[model samples]
Target: MRGAPTAAALTDRLTAQLRRRPVRAFWTALGLYAAVWWLAAVLTQLNLPLDAVEMLTWGREWQLAYWKHPPLPAWVLDLLYRLGGGSHAVLYLASPLFVALTFWAAWRLAGRILPAPLAALAVLPLVGIVYYGFTSPEFNHNVVQYPFFALLPLLLHRALAGTPASRGVAGRGPAGWSAVGRERDWLLLGLVGGLAVYAKYSTAPLLLAVALLLLCHPAGWRALAKRGPWLALGVFLLVAAPHAVALWTIDFLPLGTPAMRAAQAAGWVERLWYPAWFVAGQLVNCLGALLVLAALALPGRSEAGLGNPRSALGFDRFFVLWMLGLPLAIVLAYSLLAGQELETMWGAPYFALLGLAGLLLLPRAPSRRGLFAALGLAVLLVLAGLAGYLGKNLFEPLTSGRGMRAQFPGPALARALEAEWAQLSGGAPLPTLVGSFWLAGNAAAYGEQRPPVFIEGRPERSPWVDPAALAETGALLLWREDEAGRPPGWLAAWQGSLCPQGELVLAWQSWIELPPVRVAWATYGGRHCDRPPLAAR
Candidate 1:
């Protein structure tokens, strides 16, 4: 009997030792995330040109509802721009920081359910993928959204697993099992769900999925019959009310509105398809790899044995279905109901959640063959993605110039324009407009002037551009030829034959002199021609 007791104690000691083995997986994930962030920051800083910088700058000044996007990202960048004094280096730093944070959140979320090595391996595809590597820092909504999306799983874990007790009440149930009760969890779920909605209205469908999942749980029906879920519902409505009120007050409605309907009638499908393509395109990046792995790792319906089959379904299944399936469902439902095409950015939150879940699904004790397979696949995808990225950048002029100029290049253009403006106007303030809004925004910020005026063609169309206001300011006009087309009658009356001249040829009308000591000129591809004084001419 004494010998038996000693043998049992030895077994328990060994089990504890095995459990405490150092987690190399977490370190690997952290290292890979760091490397990816550094690479993206370096590349963005080095390769982005004047045009991209101009876009970011422009986005800041004309901070309103863009033709294709909401203004939150532009708003964030504008804040950063002001804080950093328009330094591209400082703005560039935001992207990598967000990326690193996203990865850290994913790793933490994955660690809750998976071993360290598996979690690291799961995140590998995300960092290794080219799409996430290259596009994350392009001063777009997706960049800011990624970190928030990564945090979704963590929040859910806290709610479902009961980590932050301040948010909800932890309940003990039968069989020594502990969880957040249906009533309390629903309220927490609603609050988080509302946050996602505020982050991106397109993510609204996730709330429904969460509700459905809760209802499907064993104690779900009984709890729902009580007051908790309803209270949660009220909380959701309260939280979501502001965004609705803003949209209504601003008269800025989404695709379901009358204006949106008219816009949709005119090639809305084409717009919707591009976003779909963008989503598909990300698959070539690290995000795509993890998604594929998660799909593979999903437990089949049959594999969920009879003993509390719902519990067996796991968070991975719920997450995938909620994140991936819900987006698709929303798109399909909207298309069917409202005949509106789905926007690509609408799926961003879902993809981020999928990335987290996929990493958690990595095998704890992968077979040698499985390990070899995963590595081979990862290498193959990376090479393919790199080759594609390089080919596009090298051979395709449009693709190469697209993201690069908007994010980094605009600053260079701003400096050059400032120098040109100084020489022509002698440091006097003048109104100017560049071809693209992005360019104009940068010029206004970096050029040596305050309140650079944009000429309004249709005063009613955009509040930022007011014809009456520009006329009152006595602003000089600067425009790109491609953008100028035929100047409005008022503009043409103001200056005859004032179109762009010389090798630069920015637009039909380049610059105008409002009066003495005030001059403006627009440049094309960084080239601007100096004009003799108006009296001299």
Candidate 2:
């Protein structure tokens, strides 16, 4: 009885503290969670994933836009490297950092609609979801869009709620219409929208969803008729003007490349099932979080909380449904009509509001016990994901011959390539690596000089490379091969014809279980010191 009383006292104390400082507690948990993942990354020395490598390669130049995606993620990566000394640890933190921003945004948005404790509860399930934790190590465009998705909902709620006091009492009238004409709200909305689009084209779904919701709802249609929507549009155009120009300059190459066009040509069966496959994958991805939430929620309680669909006060529920449902519907419809192969991961950023959706599905609010349970489960799942990531990077290769990219001996290969380059070029520093993105990117990252990487031997994809300067400084034309063998047919022919005298084979061992991974490398123009300044190109 004494022990039980002491435990109760301690629990009460914690409950009091949590009540007093909910926001602080939320942030502290987020920071600790991020630290755990970052430590795992550092300890394992995890190699950057393929997309991350491409991001790093693209980020090195700080271009207006990369060949594949928008420029913000690359810009953020470049900024992180500049700020944190370009270490791999710094690169790995990009995803966690963005995810935390998303969590904060979600918490803020939830606070708008729910009590502080319930807001925290709503965010717990989201953090448990695999999209935010397990698959977030790779800081791709999808991860980059998370914060924006969270922010869009938050801003949209505030704008639609029309709190005139928040917007400086712009023609105060009814609560719903008070801030409809406020220039500040429109401008902010437009700014966030433009930035979201600048991050990824996938953000268009949220944007389209918001526009369609407004057109369908009477109040929203009235608000849209005001100057707010027009102002927002003008601001979006102004903010997006540079990217529009960049797109035009590049002849809209990012829009529909050969790969995308090929995807659009998928057979009818594939197209018909793609939506179903996407839905199934999403369910699988969120299964862990769903289980945790189910444990927290009451048994057999399944109902949409909003009653009376025609009530004016039901706008908030309608807003949630529109935001969550319409985007999904659009994706499903597009896949069905276009006959395109849709990767399930493309839905990564679209699910940030899943916790709120989960809340709507419940019959009642979660109790304190349920909240703590959900949070505990989420933390465990995150740690499990982190452990799996570490195992993949540090342990898997020791037992299996299958080489993981994370275990690749980038530094070893880089050193060997540098030595061969020095011998071939007579002391000239390797200025570039021309090969497939992964091979060259690994070498570029780990090599002493940190040379620029030209993706797929193409200069346009690598804007940093000046063709004339690359010719003057020379590049190591490199490609992977089967265990100390020669380059593939095309690469071998290219090497044999272009740099016959400079051929070199590198026996790079990424793991002991497997045979040494070989790279065929050839030097091009390092013979001349008349190269352009490294900084200039």
Best-matching candidate per lDDT: 2
Per-residue alpha-carbon lDDT of candidate 1 for residues 164-222, written as tens digits (9 for 90 to 100): 22112334222332444445555765676665554445554655655665567533454
Clashes of 2: 1
Error of 1 at 286 (Å): 8.1
Q: Per-residue lDDT of 1-537 in model 2, one digit per residue for the tens?
A: 345555335434444555677677778878987787677766665467787777777888887777778899878887887798767788888988898889888888766666565566567777667888767877889899998878877777766666332233455434455555466767788899889877988788888887786677665676776787778889888898888888888777777742464466358788777788889998888887686777558443222221211222245566666787788788788778877667888888887777766665665655445544555677678778887777777677777757777766676777778886677667777777888878888787766677788776665677677767766667767776655554555464343324533334443234356656666565566564343432233
Worst 10 residues of 2 by lDDT: 303-312
Candidate 2, position 514, lDDT:
63
Error of 2 at 298 (Å): 1.9
